[model samples]
Target: MKNLLVTQYQDFVRWLTRRLGSSDLAQDALQETFLRLEQGSSIGPVHNPKAYLLRIALNMASNRRAADNRRLATSEVDKLLDLPDDAPDPARAVEAKSEISALKRALAELPARRREIFLASWIENLPHPEIARRYQISIRTVQIELKLALEYCDSRLNRRNKLRG
Candidate 1:
């Protein structure tokens, strides 16, 4: 049974990594999933091991995507956008810079988990089941977090617009 599981595990991980778009992340999630399975964590059964592992892989990918988004969003602004020294229009450049700054500030204000859900869903194009699995939470929770985060971001941006007016 153990050897069977191990062999199945490799095939599952390969399918999952291909689906999720990152070999390193797929391997990490595969390791964790097998560890859980070995400990008898009960993620269901092996009849559909591919489907089961894919679900687990999705969750792991969502978590990593969230973390990477946060890191990118918080890093130095100048480093985020690489523009050539030649400025076609100085005024447009300044406005673009200001908009980027505003976006960064808004992203920073959001709670980490909320931010992660929003980015993973919207920017990374991850499905909700994968996100829920990654966070070990329910799909409902993922939906709620994303909705609230978007509302919060919208409100904040509206307020900024009013202040500018």
Candidate 2:
């Protein structure tokens, strides 16, 4: 195998350069093929050693191409590192907190039973039928209570936004 490889090394590089479009890569692939052959890989009798050697070199080129494809280039890595973070900054964080406080105040102003039903459905993620069963009320009554609570909260938030803007 080594004798055959040495004899056809130039032919393989030329063939690979045409296939891979890079003589440098063809040389590199041939180097790896030489190293792998030196590793004493078991081989039985082969009628066509040249073809077998070409197949191994081509496979090495394919594997190197695949590995290169999966890696990020240096420019790509630098660009990604330079991108601005998505986390909210200090001013936006404070504004979000203020809005949440306003929402809590609005929810606090609801009548006791309506508040409980609203919290159960919205915060606890309880379905309407479960809320009705828990509160011993009809589904219609639960729907009405939730609607009124939502309207009251929406109005309060809208008014707050108007004042702020």
Candidate 3:
């Protein structure tokens, strides 16, 4: 299984990049696809491994886009984008930059496996069953890992905020 994943990984990524129109986003989808196999989800006798992988990647990528649209609707900036172009607020921009930096630091602090799991689950917006199958763990494990990851990063960000205030 691992051998199959290693051999065809790059090709799958390229296919995804073309489909999604972004190499960076494609790489993330690839990681999430690999994560599913890593967990042993049992797709049940895939005759064409590459095609199967592509299908999974394609599905994941589509799901991510849909999820992003859903999230965007609820986000703070969603209501503001329709407004006429105007000078951006310097304070808001600086705060956004600071928040991004803090997130990077918190991500770097995570254990390697935990970070991968977190990325595949949260950043990539993959389902728990998918993550569990890839990591060869339980859905509960994915949830637990995601919960811990969110908590750790939130704490870091909160601490940084406290310092700033």
Candidate 4:
């Protein structure tokens, strides 16, 4: 969404109008483009938001054209357009929330070193060797800590699940 802030929205829509050859289609494409961008907030930062948006928009347009082509050629492909995205049921949503809460509590309970190593390894995407080098520990030590952290979380979640049941 931050990357989208760099572009003047009206300008992108105008460009899309020229490219896609229909104002209505351009509007639809622009809305879909931003929806896609909103879905991926982890896109951090980009050097050129305009270029990124253009690429995504172009890809979206291309995909739509391809889908239309498929619909024209095959009856089965046309049915795909009518299918709706299924939302999770309330019970499933509640179960997922409880599981996530248990995981968060388990993560909080981890010892500082193991937690740090665990986060760096799993969340931050730092490699075991990189974490070892950064923390001035052997790679094997990083591996052990991460393993213990995962095991602790698993046991805690399993206990929580039994209680819930």
RMSD of 1: 24.4
Q: Per-residue lDDT for 1-165 in model 3, tens only?
A: 568768877877777788899998788777888788789866677788777778787887888788887764555576776677676699988998999998999999998878889999757988889888889999888878877778898898886334223
Per-residue C-alpha lDDT of model 4 across residues 72-156, encoded as one tens digit per residue:
5566657777788688889989999998998889989999889999989878999889999989999999988987887788898
Off by over 4 Å in 1: 1-93, 159-165
Error of 1 at 43 (Å): 82
Q: lDDT of each prediction vs. the true structure?
A: 0.74, 0.89, 0.80, 0.80
For model 1, residues 42-80, the per-residue Cα lDDT tens digits are 454468655666676678678778888777454467665
Q: For candidate 2, which ten residues in a row score worst on lDDT?
A: 156-165
- Model 2 misplaced stretches (Cα beyond 4 Å): 1-3, 18-24, 38-48, 73-84, 155-165
Clashing pairs in 3: 35-134, 36-134, 38-134, 39-133, 39-134, 39-135, 39-136
Query: Candidate 1, after superposition: displacement of residue 132 in Å?
Result: 0.9
Q: Estimated TM-score per prediction?
A: 0.38, 0.71, 0.44, 0.49
Worst 10 residues of 4 by lDDT: 156-165
Error of 4 at 136 (Å): 1.1
Error of 3 at 35 (Å): 73
lDDT of 1 at 139: 100
RMSD (Å) per prediction: 24.4, 4.1, 26.6, 19.7
